[model samples]
Target: MIVVLLAFTLASFWALIAWKGMQERALAFAKAGSETQGLTHSLAQHASKSFNAVALALFGAGQYILHSDKSARASAEINDLLAQYAKNIPQVREIGVLAENGDWMFSSFETVPAVNNGDRDYFRYHRDHPEDETPRISEPLTSRVTGRPTLLMTQRLSNPDGSFGGVIFAAIDLAYFRSFYAEFEADLNRTVTLMKTNGKVLVHRRDDQVGKDMTGTALFSGRLKDAGTGLYSIVSPFDGRTKQFAYERLSDFPIVISVAVAEDTILDGWRGDRRFDLLLGAAISTILIGLAVVLALQTRKRSVMARMLRERERGYRLLAENVEDVVTRIDMDGRRLYVSPSIEKLLGWSADEIIRESAYSNIHPAHRELIKGLIGQLGAQNRTATCEYMTRRRDGNYVWVEAQLNFVQDPDEPTAEIVGAIRDISKRKAAEEQLVAANEQLKALSETDPLTGLANRRRFDRMFDAEFKRCQRSGSQLSVLFIDIDKFKSFNDTYGHSAGDDCIRQVAGALASCLKRPADLVARYGGEEFAVLLPETAAINAEVVAEAARNAVHDLAIQHHGSPDGSVTISVGVAGGKCDARNSTSSMLAAADGALYLAKEQGRNRVCVAAENPSLTLVRPAG
Candidate 1:
């Protein structure tokens, strides 16, 4: 029995501990994952900004080199200055000046012929797009002469008379960019690569990829081009690990900068955390096992005489201390004979002070007589009693308790006594009450429009169904006004979706405010449409309300850009009363829809009531 008890205790205790530990670990992992993604996004933004800054500085230096040489004597001086500038700007490799007919007049490298670069694509691209004021950064195109990976930067030049005569073209070294990017990143394994929009690898941190064709590869295939700029995770061909990669299109340039970090690099911290948790678990298990062994050995030597008595006392003490519920024993006279240690925990009173006192005195005065009657019922039938009772704490505050009592004979004495367990149910009761309130609030929110704070489509549907049946049973009136905004689609197309949402919110607010009674329901029927259920209103009164809605919307006079009419308006349609003997719900909706079409067909911005207009019968007339 002792071994069985020990096994049970160990299994239950460790199960609880392990469950909580695993929960904490799962939460830690989720938090770490969110932080890692955030960090990667921040790094991507920084890379794009760096690319823009470098491109701008290189273009400025090249422009200064091209414009300084206006005469032959100054040509030699300008060539020397251009060479110094190219060396100073680490990202710039070669600078050259080209005429309109694609003739390169000046070259940064003296050995290269000036005529060699005349007919390149850079000069032709500038000539095609003459109106673009910004500097043109060409897509990564391989140079025919150098046969090295390069990007071209061309800025148009004006002669003294402001005529477009020539352009300054620069050949930027892609390797220099890779080195500059390497200095900015701390992770050695992280790869940074530059590529053209056309899927050619211009420069990779690895030297072998300088002139490689990367078209079929997933990274350059279309993912980066389609996304334009953002982060992506892809399987790396080089190492097979999932790489968290991000890319950005350089401003005024067709090239994209990509940064890829390995998955293991981000998970490094989580791995350390798991190791620390395992060490802590091992230490705790060792301590618990040692304590269990000592307890078992002590139990064997006591021989069950004194041990039984001590255990009984310990059991009672533990029940009082560990269990949050109150335990008490009472005499036939209803006097408290004993109370557990938790009496102090629950009521702020020591056991000594409460022993021998009338237990009913602790209960609230309003509940004392009711509890006495319940106890009488328990004794008459030899059955237990369970009830909820409010008791006064020593602090004079009230708490809710659920109590169960039954008669028992005291082992110390043969006299009968009532032993009872009372649990503090205040927190549970409060939670139940809060849960009920929250459910009700959630039900309300589900039926309400979050923007206009009006009844949403769900509420409108329910109200319409109920009101339609009520009108049918009573043979009374039920009017539904379907109001649509005039030229709402054109307004959204012209201004913006945000302004369209604002317009809907404003109109719904106006419709709700104009409602005079609680029985009148105004709802956002669908996108730009609104509905009002006016029970007991005839077609004439429904027309008045529809006209009021139309005028109310017109008075708003909300400015819209796309409409040739240039002002906001609402076209309203009203159909009311149980005219047909059958009065089907479908027929009522058709009537309202027919009226709305007439309102729109009559050049919009007007109210039309189908039930009142005898000339225009319902297209699908009431059955």
Candidate 2:
């Protein structure tokens, strides 16, 4: 019966520990899944922004160069503009502008024939649906000019009188993303995928699959439609293997990015860890069983028990007095029947004084109730327990101590005395707290931008995602502003790059200062461009913010001989929309980018808000 009871207790304890370890392992996997999703989402976010920027820049260049002039001079200007855009973007094979009749009027390439594109889906979509002015992104198709498979993006070109003039098209090479995945997945048990919202797969690294239609798959019809980002475990229909998927639905572009790792790979170490824990528990239990038998046999030698008990009592008392730990004995009523001399050294209280004073009164008030509860159980038959608590010291300070206790029957009396030992663990506890503080500080530093001493781009992305999610639930509006230091390249050319960096720092500081709301975030979006994300803000309020940021930079009055203003000034674009299921942050950024471009065109150092989606007409000159 004793053996059965012992085995059961050990098994229960081991099971509890095993369950806790499993929870930790599961939490680790969950964190890894989130990181994987973030990796893929980041890549997609950068690529999408690059595409938007290149498209807008090219369109702006075309309009500025070809306004009312289809002459050779204007064609030359368009060629130059496209050259600049294409040089920066490696994925673009060709950029072209078409006339209203769908005839290619100019190409970025040096010598190219004027081809007709009236039958193209992108061109036809813009001509038929002029109201939907957003950039039309099409699936991969063979390009007539480049003769290579490409993904096309087009924006409608309007004349000065607000009439439809033509369409500007840029063909992005699909192999660029495919090659990127090849490099991104190096020797890891991972697959990177890029697919359109229509369930058309553009690139899938593992199977070398491209342009596969996956509209019938549960992955798209189920979780992908609702969640912006999530982790899922399912058996792949294509490969018939269980895989963990970390997927993100891009907010602005109708695209989804997925990173998949096999279920076996993710759980490889956890199973081994569980097995090791079980084996360790078994070994300890076996040792404990052997020790228990020896102790029980020794306890049955009744003839010499009294003599041995006396010798052991003396030896225990001597050892207790010499040790740093304080030993104590209490009766069932909770009175201190015996106190070790070590109490004076450990707690700054004499044994006689501890016995005379209120028993256990020096325990911290916050922990007194817990100690009382534990003390009540000291009357249980031979049951041992351990707990840690903070106790008041002689100097009115608190010290942490770990206490181990058991109830022992008194030979001369009917009652049992609770024997206990208390060890100082204050140093260990302090070290743990210090380690936690250091980790928090390191994490904060990693998220902070060193140059401007503000939240960096990575941190901004995280905050934007979280706040956007919150606004969606609360039915609130989110406003975003894109700011750029006008004529920054000329600033670097006139002054050195060092001076240019100072100008950027000054601009970042000014932009941050203009924001009064705690929910507003300003981050350096690489180089001279900065972004301010405002949560729960309306268009009116955001307009005020954008104008303020522009003036703030102008107020700096930093000299720039190359700029028309002869001083550093910024162009700000503002866009506002409800952060809900129907809208994405990227759309807001695109609108703001268009507005900022308008500000630059209307004249540098101005603020413009989106007149409507995909266009900015109203301009508020910088004050």
Candidate 3:
């Protein structure tokens, strides 16, 4: 039995370790891919910035030459410089020089005559500005010469005497930037395009739009300004493929450069990483299964050896199998490494399943944090912890289990483990709750009179002590009523003891039912005598309840076994104090008893109060 348990435990531990390792490896692979893409994006952004700087520098240099030397010979020299530089820089396709009268001084095109620039917005914008040396970048406009999408950069020139000259304009070649970026071999599906601020496709990697207008395409226009230079997802303008893209705008220029890569390209290496993890997991699983089988065979061999030696192998096996409690083993890391067969019956989960899941996960949420803290304490040399917690079941119900944990270091492994037992104590807990309820019910019965189900003498005495202390502390008032059956003895003699018992029961019930507050209690003192205790009550109010009780009992007609008339009545003697310091419960009872004697002396059926000197007079009921 020991050998089999050890084998199952080792297999389960190895499986959990393998699972955690695979998950970590997958995360590492994903992080590596993101870092690689970041490097590429950083490089592309720098290259785009370099290109924009080169274009602006060339335009600024050309405008300077035209303004510094103003003669026709110098003008021809400057125009020649512009045409020659345009050919040298691959991105600068066309450059033109215009005089103050709007006649073209030079051009790169072969058959072009002197061009008029006075009507152009670029020319007028530069010419009207007086001292601003900054150049103007025009929104995309159609070029009559090339018929492709184009942006114009105009730099204002000045005469040698600081007077304004015409503008020197240049049209940057977008096709050149697109063609250069498309030649890269990193990802073939990546699309590169240059677009103008007016949502016109200036150039695309497809190369077929050299003279076409692409203003109406959705690819040319969307919400680009809101999402500044970063990764985004949209349909590709060059190939209509949905993809992830990164874009960067040219500083001090009107063009936006974008690079689009398909989703397949971004996740290119993910499948290989997943496959490698699966292979490792499968290999571990096979090794565990083989080890489990070998251990099972060894356990059987050991059992047979024990039988041959006449040892008690069956007894040991039966003891492990039929145990009534759950036994579990946890490693120093607080992971459940082993669980006994009793767990299967108690929690509806097999030992192997419990071992595979987190020990904290199986505990109810209310107990999970507490168990984690206990495990932390155990790790810090508090080697044992005993607690009762709830464990959630497979069907979503929870059961209480009392766990006893102890620490032991395995000789074969470096880490210590907690070996524990969990016993189902749900039945015990329910019995404890029932016992508590029954105790409370018995306490309530102890404070009540059996005959009238009202507060008894003992209850009245307790309440009086409490009320007296409160009144003394708060300077409040209290009252009491001493009541007696006016002719109870004669009635009992005429009607017999059973009728007397009925009369007492009837009178007590009426008095108790008439009192409203929890502080008001009516108790049967002895045969034919009753009392009412009223807290925070004055003498007059106490007399009111006493008189009401007297009348209620007088109206009672209890069936008598031996009486000539089947009836019962009571007389009350009320006494209270803002209760005077001289007055005690015994003194009050004696005075009320004196009033009762007066009522009896006058006639039966009347309530009376005692004044000074112990004189008693009958008090009539109020209308």
Give the winner by TM-score: 2
In the range 131-239, model 2's lDDT, one tens digit per residue, is 7666767896888876877788888877777677788878777777778777766634777888898988877764445778888887688787677778788787557
Each candidate structure's TM-score, on Cα atoms with residue i matched to residue i, is: 0.41, 0.52, 0.40
Considering lDDT, which of the candidate structures 1 and 2 is the better prediction for this target? 2
Against the reference, the lDDT scores of all candidates come to 0.72, 0.78, 0.68
Tens digits of per-residue lDDT, candidate 1, 352-386, equal 88874588988988999998887766653576888
Q: Report the error of model 3 at residue 315, Å.
A: 36
Give the per-residue Cα lDDT of candidate 2 at 265.
76
Name the regions of candidate 3 deviating beyond 4 angstroms. Answer: 1-70, 108-112, 117-121, 124-133, 138-151, 158-164, 185-188, 208-227, 235-240, 299-623
TM-score, model 2 to reference: 0.52
lDDT: which candidate is best? 2
TM-score of the candidate numbered 3?
0.40
Q: After superposing candidate 2 on the true structure, give the runs of residues whose Cα lies further than 4 Å from its correct spot.
A: 1-5, 13-21, 66-68, 206-208, 300-623
Model 2 / residue 491 / CA error / Å: 21
Q: Indicate whether candidate 1 or candidate 2 has the larger TM-score.
A: 2
